[model samples]
Target: MPRAKDLDTVAPDDFLNSTLKSPLPPRPIKKPQNKKIKHLHQSSNGKSHSAQFRQNVYGILGKTKHPFSSFLVKPKVFNFRERDTDEEIILVLRRHWITNLTWILITLSMIIAPILLTTVPLLESFPPAYQFISIIFWYLITFIYSFEQLLSWYFNVYIITDERVIDIDFNNLLSKNFSEAKISMIQDVTSTIIGVSQTFFNFGNIQIQTAAEVPEITFEKVPNPEIIIKVLGQLRQEEELENIEGRVK
Candidate 1:
């Protein structure tokens, strides 16, 4: 805008002629094309970084999935009998799969026991019917033992949820022992990987000391004991923080 002194210096006729003409068409702004291209590239790079970060997070969350896995994290299709609706399971574990080797070896031996025994004259002294019945009985016993062990290994599970720690054990087909302790009650966690096999397989036992009815709960031969301990520690911290917040209110 012209200042008062500059306007006073201009001729009235010139000022009138300038205002009277159709206002010059406003000049179109010239955008810097290179700056726009650079801005677009930066935005694309940010989006890619954000997408990669989300993918990594999902990979961490869905770390385990195999149904027979001894150690699982954030399982998608598992639920327990006594679990609360709001409680979320963070970890599900059983004895390391390698622990089943003892029974597996024994079962394999039992399967071939009859063949090995054929080299002996033990059945020669008996009648044909007696020998048949005896062999049948031996195999029956072996089958029963194998079945029982399979059930035991499959059913005995230790679970860690956002709210509690649970141990489920089946001593027999008809009997199950269920033990649980709140995350808030857990005081200390101790892990032991004693023998060569345990160390080699990276599996061990973990003892949890809690203020719940069961003072100490032990998970025998579970995989990733240190990771379990770390998760428990995190849960305990969260529980304590929640308690403090509750008390403040």
Candidate 2:
């Protein structure tokens, strides 16, 4: 070996020439991935939107998904008389359309039975006076069946407001059941979707446990019970925040 100093030290010109001849590798060019990400985000958002209101509970009444608008006795204004000025109706829910099938079948049978009876030999044997009376009785029964079933369905509703949740049940022409609980009083929520029809139609029941007088409130056969549970949770969180900020209304 020559001098150690000579071996260890290279000329500045040689080092400069080596770097100039062999340049450092270029950094990998990144392709634009924004389009792919944007497309995915949009599709996810669309799916969520469509799933939220997939089926309308008021299909018999109208095309409207909203219960308030579908009602024949809908108010011109949103604010119902007894509700506070600040209270707003977040949602008005009715039992799923599947639940009304029983009443609908009964009404249809009541309507068709009269026509079927007329063709029977037993009705033909009756006197004119008796036949007329029979026809009147048949029609009266039909009317009552139709009226009662329709009235019960139309009046029975679950109202969720900013302040509370109300369950209005119409038992008959003269009797009704009403239950309500404040939003803040709600403690837990459970949703159940049992039966093939319920699973297929995406309708279910929501059971809410509360700290109020009524410990538990069940919303039976309601459409989109999972979404309702999510909404109740969000509403409770909001109510809690409002209370903390002293903005309770």
Candidate 3:
């Protein structure tokens, strides 16, 4: 081999020129992607304009899902009366079936009696006027039954709300009386189911003694008066506890 120093003689200028002359590999060109812009419209104008454009957008874009943005505004507090702890109130109503029973029986009687009387040969021998009067009487009886039932359903209705007890008495369609008492006033509750008829029928009366002007409130011919009395008692106890706590507070 020739002398090492002579064989490796290289110029920096020539090396640089060779490197600069070499072609670079082609680069991939990336295309720009179109994106949708969301804008909120001014509430007064009901239209929104994009920052990049002057055209008004008809509808809201990306509006907040919650309409009540209360965080952006001051919160408000409302004042209301709190319930007394020593009072428990409940709603009571006559059983639907019991209330409707009189109507059902009357209707059955009206239908059966007329048919039985008119179909009998001897009864049919009565004058046409008598038959007409009998028919009228039957209709009258049915009307009376209907009227009574409607009156009872309307007036005899009792509602026990948390705050008070309400008694409604409808003597006729035209006559009505309403009474109410606070649960705190309730002193005594009595339930009575008298006779085999009432026991079998599951109907009875509930009597309430109160501290109010009205000494006693009686709910007549109500269903499951015992259960109602028990519930009322429990409510009364709860109310008493609440009252004691309230006094302490």
Judging by TM-score against the true structure, name the best candidate.
Answer: 1
Across 73-188, the per-residue lDDT of candidate 3 in tens digits comes to 11122111233564332344654355476678877887778777767889767899999997898889888887777656644666564456667776776767777677688999
Clashing pairs in 3: 85-239, 85-242, 86-239, 86-240, 86-243, 87-239, 90-160, 91-160, 155-170
- How would you order the candidates by TM-score, starting with the best? 1, 2, 3
lDDT of each: 0.82, 0.72, 0.58
Regions of candidate 1 where Cα sits further than 4 Å from its true position: 1-62, 247-249
Task: Report clash pairs, candidate 1.
Answer: none
Segments of candidate 3 deviating more than 4 angstroms: 1-90, 99-103, 119-137, 245-249
Better of 2 and 3 by TM-score: 2
lDDT for predicted candidate 2 compared with the true structure: 0.72
By TM-score, the better pick of 1 and 2 is: 1
* Every model: Cα RMSD to truth: 11.5, 15.6, 23.7
Residues forming the 10-long window of minimal summed lDDT in candidate 2: 53-62
**Candidate 1 lDDT over residue span 1-249, tens digit each:** 754547668877778887988587889999767988887876676556545533443354458858788887777887889988877788889999998999999999999998888778876888989888988999999999999999899889998887789999889988899999988889889999998999999999899999999999999999988778777776666566556544211
Q: Write the per-residue lDDT of candidate 2 for residues 66-106, one digit (tens) a residue.
A: 54432222233444445777666766777777777888888
